[model samples]
Target: MHIGLISILSLVAVVSAWLPSDTDLFGPEPQTNATFSNLSAGKGRVVKKWLPSSGKIRGVNLGSLFVVEPWMASTEWATMGCGSSKSEFDCVMKLGQDAANAAFKAHWARWITETDFDDMASYGLNTVRIPLGYWIDESLVYDSEHFPQGGLAYLDKVVGWAAARNIYVILDLHAAPGAQVAQQPFTGQYAPTTGFYQDYQYDRAYKFLQFITNRIHSNTAYRTVGMLEVLNEPVNGQSSLVNTYYPTAFSKIRETESGLGITDNAKKLHVQFMNKLWGSGDPKSGLKDLSNTAFDNHRYLKWDTSVKVSQAGYIAASCADQVASDGDKPLIVGEWSISPADAVEQSSAFEVKSGSNSGFYTKWWAAQVIAYEKQQGWVFWSWKAQLNGDYRWSYKDAVEKGIIPKDPGQAYNQGVC
Candidate 1:
């Protein structure tokens, strides 16, 4: 959709103000009113609430939802290849420009809007996490004239579509500058150390979070945008790295956006301290962490053919306990993907394959896990990704006839109160 002339002009003016230098999108003012509020004792568990008449998650089951990265939603998009070249910034800039344009087109927009969400809602999904790139917000970049209007307008449309169907949208900042996942898509590089802890990149990330929190909280339509994921799969190689930065960033965001109240005060502080303590690896730091915020963790079992899933249950339980010990705060399995084989083996200690037991195994295992941990909510690994040939990870297949049965798009509408 074409952006309104007024918005386009306004964005152009903003862009001109920061052409030569990347100005701070989040101004220097200290947001003071933002403070954490503690949850009452015994009320720390993930409670089931029904969706309000406005079609939002109020009280409901912590079920899986199909997630799609709309910023990467393009027919021509490919895995990270440009970063391997010498001039990484040039390559990234070129790719980013192309991606931005392609994402704006109606073709990509309609594909994600029509196919992904509609089909996911039909597949017993209560929520859909849409991972947007930090660059999408023109206000953050301050150099792109087309960004503020185009990106914001497109996202506005996305939120409107989901709200109409009562589908909860989790706004995930997947492609943070520091490469939250430490690899392609975010940094356009593969296992590179140079991009790991760049100060400027981290600064950019902090700014992006502020921009997103401000933008979403400002729009009433996005109240359905339940949570803001600080970072996606922040590598555990060194806990100190994130621990030192996360709290600082979290404080900045909370101060900037008062609407995103510190819902679970104790839990939030605890997680932040845990992140720092874990990063620092200093047990005797004598840091007492607070609690009351939702903690995000991603898990893929050993059998998933990527990371060993054996530790999946352990990681989940451990994180839960951490939150509980500090205070009672909700834990969200921000991302996970386990086939029938992995799920069955984990749940009932039975090995299964994807072919013969595809249907039974998938359904049984998914239900088993969801039932196993009724408190902590989860959003499945992905709805789609850059893949080749026939792949189980393809949401296209799940939407068609793979994981979903009957009308996949309407499956989420069932049992959604």
Candidate 2:
């Protein structure tokens, strides 16, 4: 639970030699590889190809694990003296560093275990998208920052367990130094003003990216961590963030790979970026100058207010979605689940649709899997909810109830879509 300030800050010192100055424009070299043999595919601008073996990545997200969102673990949030706090930053502030660290230590210890990974393998899931806060490298976190320490150790356990089960890990930077957007607990804090665009915040996030990219490639414990999602759901309107930040991140990751002698096309981690943004732009345009990356697409019909509420409507929407990216890059549905409610726009996403009629959820799940296989693949929004026992959001619950098949690849209601 203590900070390893020295080791964490060393990441900056190392990457500083290759990092581009803030004023300089950054982009990728022209991609030469036609098709990345096995891992992920990126077109246009890329270094080494890291295409998937199965073409599609069948996975689930380890939600509310490293970055604790209170609603998902309400009981632990309250018992750990975090009931009043929405984000881990606030929770640490309220509980004081020591108590919060103890709570998180225990929470992370059991949130998901080796048994969970075994279950995933049994269910035929091959990947886990883990959401981590920047504070995982506690040194970059300012003294004023209030996130708990010692997340990296827990992450080590996770990847080790995952690798044993032949499951890959997609390390996602879910939270940044300053919240990427204002008032979002998932970003690690909720505040009226967003500060991720500031110079210092951008630098910290960059350092963390360098740190993780290096760790993924260097550590034997992280052998199964084949993907590094650069950032998760960053604010959409920042042009500089999309243009400069992304290219720089891509460059830094390649630099890390080079430093570690990871020149092979197959051994590299697939750097993932959002396929599209709300206002700014997408990877195709922003990252036009780079490759050796994958695009992330998060789909949800509940908040869309675009898809109909009826059962057939959900199936149609799933079948109609374009899982394939506009460019040649692999498209990953990083976060998605069954949105059963009508016209409700909540990121908390309580889709407890499977009651007695497993028929409905079974059919819908198949429709999505069938459709998503067109591109790289999809990872469900979550593995399980710790407290609520909501079947829709819990892959374990759904699997047990026969809502989602034990063998996820086998679509129960095949051709139903």
Candidate 3:
């Protein structure tokens, strides 16, 4: 598809006023009336009762924040001259311990602000999936000096912010001690030998989860954090290891919470595990013995090279087939976007410059609403993107341009759908 660079850059002018600078986005006063103290003991879930007609996990991923990917945020890692770096860990190492810490200290504050959380609630998103790596934990056997301190504190700040806005948080461990997937910077892997299949890596990952669970249990505000995902996109062949780790971590987390005297049944957190390659297999088959668990699947229509159909046709076909296979599983579309992949040709349906264009927007919108109704809920791939023409993938721009409904509840019937 042809990208209209002029049209995309002009949007920067429209959003510049709302974007966070050295000045706070919330201004002198906060926008949310909700407080953590009054936050219901009932944490969000994907099961039957938890499912709202609006959609369960109706949210978007806070990508390129905790997990630094070069393409998404090149300036953040630019200090290391990491333009061509393979992973976040490698980028940090290249920057050296001291420089890396200094860069992150500045970035952690600016990358995302409290106002962003307020905006999420204002626009219809009810949840956020924050992806973080194992290195953030002080107890993990990693290069502590390289990673800046107060990582958990930052996380707590986000939880509190979400709680104040009455939004749910899903603490996703995007990158484990060793990488879980290859050819992806989010995995935080530099060496080929480091991966989930290794016993030592698995052990450290489990410990990190245990530590995180304890931290959440201790925080009153963080009770808004309703779900804890074990891992993200393990290599396809490692399904057996992932299957084994799911129950082990699930039981361990429950055992840890019980030991801490946190017995609120409503706040019972669901442990989420992704099926091989984003719901390629039956989640029930893999998680038969586990309870209080849910399945996560990423539905990126553009990425499926096997399907060479029009955008609307592909979306309809995929949604119909996947919805049928979902059956009774508590499934969540953890990541999805309307952006076409790479340099390949995009469907003529989405050639328009503005996300508000009906031909491009309606098809994607209908598919998502249909998917949410069929399964538990869905979280879009990203909350924002750079001044690229792919406005559909950028939630902020989409909402601003009236492409996506400000109230996600209204998204079901915004127009042509």
Candidate 4:
């Protein structure tokens, strides 16, 4: 999700046509049959198990991909100078279809490349959480869909790249069929309402989910796609609906993917569910009763008005909250960032220097985050930022500048998964 004008992989070489450069990690060409031997155990539940307290995953999110956040590409949006656009759909439509298509093409090509993925692996991150809007698949987009058409192909390329490097992918449905959370452009709904809670939208979203499950589970190159979140951060009070959706989605996915030769019941792809913005561990939380499910909570410090502590105090508070909320449950901190309270309203130029709150604060914060997340696992809000100066939000810049430790041991505690 893009906030105002603010926010937002890979190694090449195993991919034959990915890049003009000759630095492929997998080999001269990508492996035809990829295997997760070291990471997979007893039907691949080992990988899913790696998500909880038993094993740990340190990772980063691939944000602003299928969904674009205006602030990430503020400069591009500034060219149009459209006033107060709501979502990417509005922004693109404002630009006119032809111009929007061309601009998106350039932005997509440059925003992320094979070299980026290579950098992530080198940074020691074991998992990459990729955010995707529901319309990525053409059938889901319907008549109003006007963006360039290779969305799924681009996703396949990224997943394939991750597989070659032995990194896992958490394919997150950031935007559901009808804007699960319509406030942001990330949800792909240009209108005022998310529309996802309605019966019509819910049915469309359910079918879309089924389509996604069948496609990925059937693809060999996507063996590294370890988890598929039903939706990212649905609005509050939809818990009962979300709860119903989860079991139905799980059953649909399970039935569709059952042909993959799975014998052990525990070893299957993880279907992650959020609490749907319900209070932490609420009795009505959708995730409470789902099987083969994982809990995902997005934790943020800067957004909490009550976060008046110093870096140390903030760490203690955050760690305590996470510990309490996720005691022995299979969970992941699906979204987090290194942003500090003191620098909350600053510009990217002013914010990037000294690593958000100076070197000592940033390093200490990163260490604490890694340590806290060891109970289960965590994914930073983003791997990179559109504004290079905004290193506080970008794992790539943080690691490169040494504000955050680049040691693989810190980023990857769960071995290969």
Expressed as tens digits, the lDDT of each residue in 1-417 for candidate 2 is 335322332222111111010101111222333233222212221222222232357889999999887776788677777878878888999889998889998989888989999898888887889998999987787878898887787887788788666566788989887788788888989877788876788788888988888776555556557678777887777887777777877877888778866665455667888776333367666665554577787877667677876778888988887755467366778888764764432222324533544676778888888887777678998898754555667788789877787877678346675
Worst 10 residues of 3 by lDDT: 13-22
lDDT of 4 by residue, 60-134 (tens): 898876677776656645554434665667766677767766666666666778888888878777778899877
* Per-prediction CA RMSD (Å): 11.8, 8.0, 10.9, 8.8
- Candidate 3 lDDT for residue 241: 62
lDDT of 1 by residue, 102-199 (tens): 43353335545555666666665656666666655554553522221255566776765665665666676665664555435443233345343556
Compare candidates 2 and 3 on lDDT and give the better one: 2
Q: Supply candidate 3's per-residue lDDT for 79.
A: 52
Off by over 4 Å in 1: 1-107, 142-149, 187-191, 194-199, 239-242, 259-292, 302-328, 339-355, 385-391, 405-417
Off by over 4 Å in 4: 1-55, 76-85, 96-99, 144-148, 259-263, 276-289, 323-328, 342-356, 408-417
Candidate 4, position 53, lDDT: 24
Task: Assess candidate 1 and give its lDDT.
Answer: 0.42
- Candidate No. with top TM-score: 2
Ranking by lDDT: 2, 3, 4, 1
Give the candidates in order of TM-score, highest first: 2, 3, 4, 1
| Model 3 steric clash pairs | none
lDDT of each: 0.42, 0.71, 0.63, 0.60
Clashes of each: 35, 10, 0, 12
User: lDDT value for candidate 4?
Assistant: 0.60
Per-residue lDDT of model 3, residues 1-417, tens digit only: 111111222122111000011112122232344221111332232221211122355788988777777776655557546667777666666777666666666666777789898888888777788998887776674544244444665676777788687576788889887677666778765556546677687788888888777766655556457678888876555555655666677777777777765554444567877754464344456555555566687777677776555665666655564633434456778888776655543444555463334555655665676666467777887887664555666788777776777877675564433
Candidate number that wins on lDDT, 1 or 4: 4
